[model samples]
Target chain A: MVHLVIDGKGFQAEEGQNVLEVALENGIEIPHLCYHEQLSPYGGCRLCLVEITRGARTFLSTSCTYPCLEGLVVRTDTPDVLRARRLVLELLMPLAPEAPRLQALARQMGVTETRFASDEEVDDCIRCGLCIRACAELVGAEAITFSGRGERRKVEPPFGEEALNCIGCGACVFLCPTGCLHMEDQDGVRTLDKWKRTLSLKACASCGRRYLPFAQIEFARQKGEDPPAEGWFEFCPDCR
Target chain B: MGKQAIERIVEKYGSDHADVLEMLIDIQEKEHYLSRETLQYLSERLAVPLTRLYHMATFYEALSLKRRGRHQIHVCMGTACHVRGAARILEQLERCLSIKSGEVTPDLQFGLATVNCVGTCALGPVVSVDGEYHGHMSASKVERMLKRYSETEANGVAVCQK
Candidate 1:
C-alpha cells in the first residue's frame, strides 16, 4: 500500500494501483474513455490527464496509465490538466459529433464548442481501442482488432471481413464508450453488424425464448466451462 | 525459397514470441510482401495470434501486406531532396508509370514509393531501385531508369542490371 494526495485529499492505495482507479475508487472523478476494469490499462484516450508532483518532478500524465507512488500529489482539475484534457475532447468533438458520451463529457468539462470541429458527418468511433481490448482480453475471441495507422487507424477485424471466430458476444458493444459498435438480436439471430457476424440465438428449452448465442456456450465449454446442472443451459435464467 | 524463410524463422525464434516482428521482417525480405496465406501459415507455425500479426503488418511502413512489383523504386522526399527537384522526379515517374507514387504498375514491372531520407542528402533527389541507389536524379532520368527494368520478366524478379 502507498499513500497519495489526490485533490488535496489523502488516501491509501495498492502499490501497483493506477492513479485513475484510486481516484475513482475514492469518489474523485477523473473523466476517461479508454480505461476498463477487466482489461489492461491502455491510455489511448487522453481525457484522463492529471497533474502529478512526485517528490520534485511535476508532470502531466494520463492517470489511467500512471501508477500511484508514495507521497504522490495528483491534481485532476488543474488549469494545465484541464487545458490538456479539454484540448483532447475538442479534437474528438467533431470526429464523433453525435456521440452522447462525448457531448456530455464536453459539457461537464465546460468545452461548449470546438474551433477544430468541422460540420462533416464522420464515424462516431473515437478509436479508443476499448472494444478491441475487451474482445481480446475479456471475450478471448480476438475477433476484433486495430488496423492502419495515424489518420487511418481504426478498430476492425481481419481484413475488415466477417469474423468467423467471433461467438457473437456483445461485450464489445456493451463496453464501447461512444456506442459506435452495435449489436442486435432479432428473428432468433444475433447480428453484430459492425463485425459482419451473425449467430443463431439459443432458445430456452423451457421458456422458448432466445437468451444467448449457441456459439458463446460452445466457446465457454471449449474453455473448460460446464453448466451448473446437466440441463442447466437448456433453459433461460428466469426459467432455471 | 519463400516457404524456407518461414520454416527457418520459426525454427530460430519459435519459442520467443517477442521476436514476431523480426520473423515478419525476415519473411517480407524474402517474399517482398506479406500475403494472407503467408500470415495464416505463420500464425499456425509460430502460435501467434493473427490479429497481432495483422497489426504489425499494417502498422509498419517497412512491411507490406500486398504483392509488390518485380522491382521496387524508392524516391527520397527529404527536405534536402525536395529542394533539389525530388517532387518533379516523383511526378515524372508517376506520369510514366500511370500510377501514384505508392502504387505499382498493373503490369507488376515497377513499384514506386517515396522515402523520407536515405542519409545521402548531399546527393539530393536520390532514387533507389531494388537495392541500388541513383543520385542527383531529375524528371528526365526516370524513363532511362524504367527502360532498364521494363523488359524484365513481369512474372519474375532480378534480371541483374549493372
Candidate 2:
C-alpha cells in the first residue's frame, strides 16, 4: 500500500496501479480513452492528463501511464488539467467527427462544437496501438504490423497478403473499443451476435434435406466444375 | 453402453455443473441429442433447475437442444473466409441440401451451421465436417464431400472416422 494525497484528500492505494486506475478504483472520475484494462496503456490519446505537485515542482502528465508512488500529491480536476484535456478532445474531433462516443465526451467537457474544419475523409482506427500491442503482448502472433510512415500508416499482414498465422481468436475484434475491426465466417456469413446464427445443411438435388456446404457448391459452379459424389452428400434443409 | 453403466457413472460423479455439461455432451455424442428422459435424469442428479440448465444449453454456440443428424457440417465465416467467396460455397451447400442453415432433413442424415472464425485464415474458405478441416474449397468440392458422407450413411458407417 502507498499513501497519496489527491486533490487535498489523503488516500491509500496499491503500489503498482497508475494514477488513473487508482482514482477510478476509488470512485474519482477521469476522462480517458485508449486505456482499456485488458490491454497495455499506450497513453496516445493524452486525454487523462493531470497536474501533480511534489515539494515545489508541478508538472502535467498522463494519469493512465503514470504509476502511483508513495507521498505523491495529485490534483486531477485542476483548471490547467481541464484546459489540456479539452484541447485534446478538440484535436480529435476533426479526425473522427462521426464517432458518437467522442462527440458525447466533447459535449460533456463544455465544447459546443469543433473549432477546426472537419476532415471529411478518415479511417476507423485512431492509431491508438491497442491492437498492435494486443497481438504482440497477448496473442503472441506477430502476424499484423503497422505499415508505412506518418499519415499513410496502417495495419497489414506480411506482403499485404491475408494473414496466414491469424488464429481467428477474435481477441482483436473484442478489444477494439471503437468497433472498427470486423470479422465474418469462412462462408462469408457474418453474425455480430455470435449465438443468433443457425447451422443447417444445403439441399441436395436428389434428396430433400441432405447435408452440403453451400459456399463450396457455389464456388464449384462458378469454376465450371462438378462436385464429387463420394465425400459430399446433398439433401434438403429438412432432410439434412 | 448399458443402462447400469450409465447409472453407475452418474452416481459416481454426483452431477456438478461442469460435470453436467460434460455428461450432456457425452450423452449427445452417443445418442445424437439429449432425449427427454436424459434431460430429466440430468436435472435430478445435478440438482440444477431444469429451466436454468435449458438456458445454459441454449446460450452457448456449441450446444444444441434438438436432435442432430448423423453428420455435422460447420462452415467458417471469419473475415478472411468471407473475402474469398465463402458465401458462394454456402449457397451451393444450401442448394444441395434442400434445407436452410439450421434445419435438419426428415431422415436426420446431416446438420449444418455457420461458425465464427476458426483461426485458419490461410485457408480463407474452410469447412469442418465432423471436426475434420477442409481448406481451399469450392462449391463443387463441397458437393463431392456430401456425396461421400451419403455413401457412408448407406454403408451404416460414420463418415468422420479418423
| TM-scores vs. true structure, each candidate | 0.91, 0.45
Give the deviation of candidate 1 from the true structure as CA RMSD. Answer: 3.2
Clashes of each: 0, 75
- CA shift at A155, candidate 2, in angstroms? 3.3
Candidate 1 C-alpha error for residue B52, in Å: 1.0
Residue A60 of candidate 1: its Cα lDDT?
97
Candidate 2 has a DockQ of 0.01
Candidate 2 displacement at residue B76 in angstroms = 53
Summed over model 2, clashes come to 75
Colliding pairs, model 1: none
How many Å off is the CA of B27 in candidate 1?
Answer: 1.4
lDDT of 2 by residue, B70-134 (tens): 78887888899998888888887777776678777556888778887889999879988878889
